[model samples]
Target: MFPTFPHRKWYEQRIDTMEELEQHVLNAHFPEDAYFRGMPSADFICISSFYRQYLQDNKDSLNWSEQQVGIGVTMSLPEVGKQQYKESSFEILDYFYKCLRELGSKELSFNSIAYLAQHYGLPTNLIDFSADPKISLFFACFDEKEWFTDKDCTLYVSDILWHVKAMMPSNQTIPMGYFKHPTENRGMTEAEADEMMFNMFTTIDKDSSETVTPKIELDEVKYSARIHNQKGVFVYHCDDVPFDRIMHTSNCNDGFNKVFVINKELKPKILEKLNNEYKINEKFVYPDVEEDPNLDLILAAAEKTKQKFDLP
Candidate 1:
C-alpha cells in the first residue's frame, strides 16, 4: 500500500520547528522512545500520517495481527533520503495494522502500545493531549510487559453540551463518549450548566487545595458527580447512568459519587460564592486553556488521580 510520491523532496523543503516537533511527538502512533534509534523526526511524521489516514479510511476492513489487536499511529519527517524512510515507515505501519487485525480481538491499552513501541527502540510519538493540536493522534507499538490486547480497552467520548453547560473553568471538553447521557438530545441550558460546572470545580479545587498534596482521584469523583447531577446523567465507560442511580452503584462511595450530588445541588450557590471571592478567569482558563501552565497542573492532578484509581 506504499505510494510512490516524492516524500524526500517534501522533507528537504520544510524546516521542522519546536511546534512541529511537539506536534510530531503528539501525533505519533507509538511511544517517544520507539523511533529514537536515529530515525529522522520528519520522516517519522510522514510515515505515521500515511498509516493513520490509511487505517482511519479503511477501519472496517482492517484487522489485527495473530496476537495483536491494537494499532499505533504517528508521523515523522527527516532531512536526507526522505523518500526511502517515508516508504519504509509506511510499510511498517501498514504491516502493524494488518498484524493487529490478524490477532483476532485481543485486548489492547494505550499504555500497553506505548510500552511496546518504547521497547522496540522505535519512537512511539505519543501525544500529550494537554498540549496544542490537542486532538492530534500519534504513533505507538506493542510491548509484552505493558501491552494490553484490543479486547481490554473501552472507548468513551465526552459530551459536548455537557461541557458547554457545565461552563467548566478549564473548559476541558471530553471527546464524544465521556458522557452517559445523549449530549445531542439532552436539552440543557448552557448558562445553568456552566454555573453548575463552576460550582463543582470550585468545590473540588477547594477540597484538593486544602490537602498538602491534593488527591486528584478524590476530586475527579467530585467533579464527575457534579456533572452527573447537573446533567441528570453520568457516563461510566460509555454507559449512561442516571445521576440518582449512579449514587447506588457499589463503588459510589468512592468519593466521586458523593461529590456528584454536591455539584448538582449546590453548584449554583458555590459559584455565587466563588464569583464574589475570586476574579473572573483568574482561577482557570477556558476556550484555549490547553497551553496554560495552570491548566497543566490541573491535568497533572487528574493524571495522578487516574493512577490512584488504577484506571486504564
Candidate 2:
C-alpha cells in the first residue's frame, strides 16, 4: 500500500527543529512535485516547524545517523508547469487536466484521478470542503483506468510524478532497478533448464483469461512470461506490451525483467514424475479455448525446470 499523509495534529506536532525536519524530508526522498503539491509554501513551513518540535519532544522514540541527514533543504518543488491561470482553483484544475492529457498521449493507464488530486494536495473530497465544484467535476470526467492500477488503486500517482519529472528541462529521469541482488544464490540447474523454465512460465497462468484471451474479447489477456531461475518462480502477467516483452524476450536489459527464485532442488526425473502424477497438463488451459495436451506438456516442463534448484 502507498504511504499516506499524517492526519492527526499530534503526529504532525511530533517533528521539531530545522535539523530534525530536514532529516525527515531527506529520508523521504519524496518527488519534488509531490512535496509541493501536497504542501504549499505556508503549509510547508508550518509542517517543517511542527515536525522539528515533534522530533525534539519525542527524542527517545527517534534516532538519526549522520549519513541519514547528509543533505538539508535542497528539496525541489513539484513542476506546476506554466501557471496560465490566476485563480488558485482554476489553476489546480487545469494542472490536473494537463497531466491527464500528457499521460494519455504516452499511453499510460490510471485508476483514479482522486489519488492524483490528493497527491497534489488538492481537496479530494471537496463537496463539503471549501474547494470549487469544478475541481470535483474534473476528476469525474476521467475513467478509473485513466489513473489507477491493480497494485494500489491509487490513480497511478507514481507515474504522474514520473511524467512531471520527465517534462522538466534539466530533470534526468532514472528508471529504478527492478532486480533482486545478483550475488544471492538461488541454486543450480540441469542442462534442460531453459526449456523447462519457459514451459513453467507459460503454464503458471494458463487459465488466466486476461493473458490468453483474444484481443477482441472484452477481457483479453495481454501478457507474457519469464522464468527467473535465481528467484525460482514464473513472473507473468504484465500490463504493458513492452514490459511483457522485456520479461520474455531474450537479450533485453536485465533490469526490467521479472524474476522468480526457485526454492527447491529436484532431479531431472522429478519433471517426469510431476508431469504424470500431477496431471499438470490439465491445468494449462488457454483463454477462451479448450485444453491442449501438447501446450500443457510444454508448460509443465518449464515449471519443473523452475523448481530444479532450492535456495536455502
Candidate 3:
C-alpha cells in the first residue's frame, strides 16, 4: 500500500489511542535526529504559509510551461533570475529585520530573524516542529479557535538524515558522515549538530541548485520564550516545492516519511491526556513573556502581592 525500501519507507496509519500512537512511533524507531510536526487537519500538507500564499497570489502561472514557470510548480516568481526569487523572499524578511532592529534586537542572523518572524505570525518558508513526539501530538489535538475541531489531525515523523539525502540535488553527494547519528560509536555534540545543520541549510553558493532538498533544521540563535517552552525547532524549505511533495517524490532508496492521522472523535481525549497527564497545556507550551500586556500586568500584580506578604 505504501512505497518501501530496504532501509526506509513512506507510510501512514490511522491512530486512535495514545497507546497506539506511542506504539506506532516506537515501531518506527526513529533516530535521535528525528523531528515531529502536528497539524490541526490531516489534509494539510507540510507547506509554509508564505509559499502557500505565493502560489495563491500567482495562480495563473500554474499553467505556464516549465521553462516559463522557472523555479517549479509552486514558485511562480518572474524568471528574470535567482536575484528576483531571493528579493521576493527577502522583501518581507528585510522589513521584519528592520522592525526588530528598531526594537533593539540587533545582530540577528538572517535565519534567526526569519524564525522570529514565523513565531510572531509572519509567513516564511519555515515549519515548526518539536523534539518531543507527544508535544507535536499536543498541538495536533488542541486548537483553541475550534476551526479544525471536527477534522482529523496529522502527526509527522521525519528522519533528518534520510530527509536531507532525499532532498539533495541529483549530482551532489550528501555528506552523511558530517552528522554522527546517536547510534554511531562517536556522537556529535548538540551544539555541533545544530551548527552543522544550520550551515547546510543557510549557505548559498555555486553548488546550490533549484531542486528541492529535504527540509533542514535551523539553529535557534534568537531566544523566543514561546519557542523555548514549546521545544520549538524549525525546518527550512530550501526550494519552491511543498514539503510533503518533496517527501513523496524523493528518489532516495532510504528516505522515510510517516504520518499518523489522528481520529477526530478522539481529539478531546488526546488533548485531555496531554494536558492533564502529560502537563502540556497551552500555558506550558507558551510561557508568559513581557511582550504580552495581560501577562505583564498579571506578573506585576503577583509580584506586588508577594512583596506585601513579605512586610515585617
Winning model by lDDT = 3
lDDT per residue (tens digit) for residues 62-137 in model 3: 4432222112323323222345554565666666666555555546566566666666656566677787887888
Stretches of model 2 off by over 4 angstroms after superposition: 1-157, 160-298
- On the 0 to 100 scale, the lDDT of residue 6 in model 3 is 17
Which lDDT value does model 2 have at 45? 19
Best by TM-score: 3
For all candidates, the clash counts are 79, 39, 2
Q: Give one digit per residue, the lDDT tens place, for model 2 in 14-55.
A: 222324323443233433322111111111111122123233
Model 3 scores a C-alpha lDDT of 0.59
Judge candidate 3 at residue 271 and give its lDDT.
78
Write down the TM-score for model 3.
0.67
lDDT of each: 0.26, 0.23, 0.59
**Clashing residue pairs in candidate 3, if any?**
167-213, 167-214
Ranking by lDDT: 3, 1, 2
lDDT of 1 by residue, 72-100 (tens): 31112111233442343334333332343
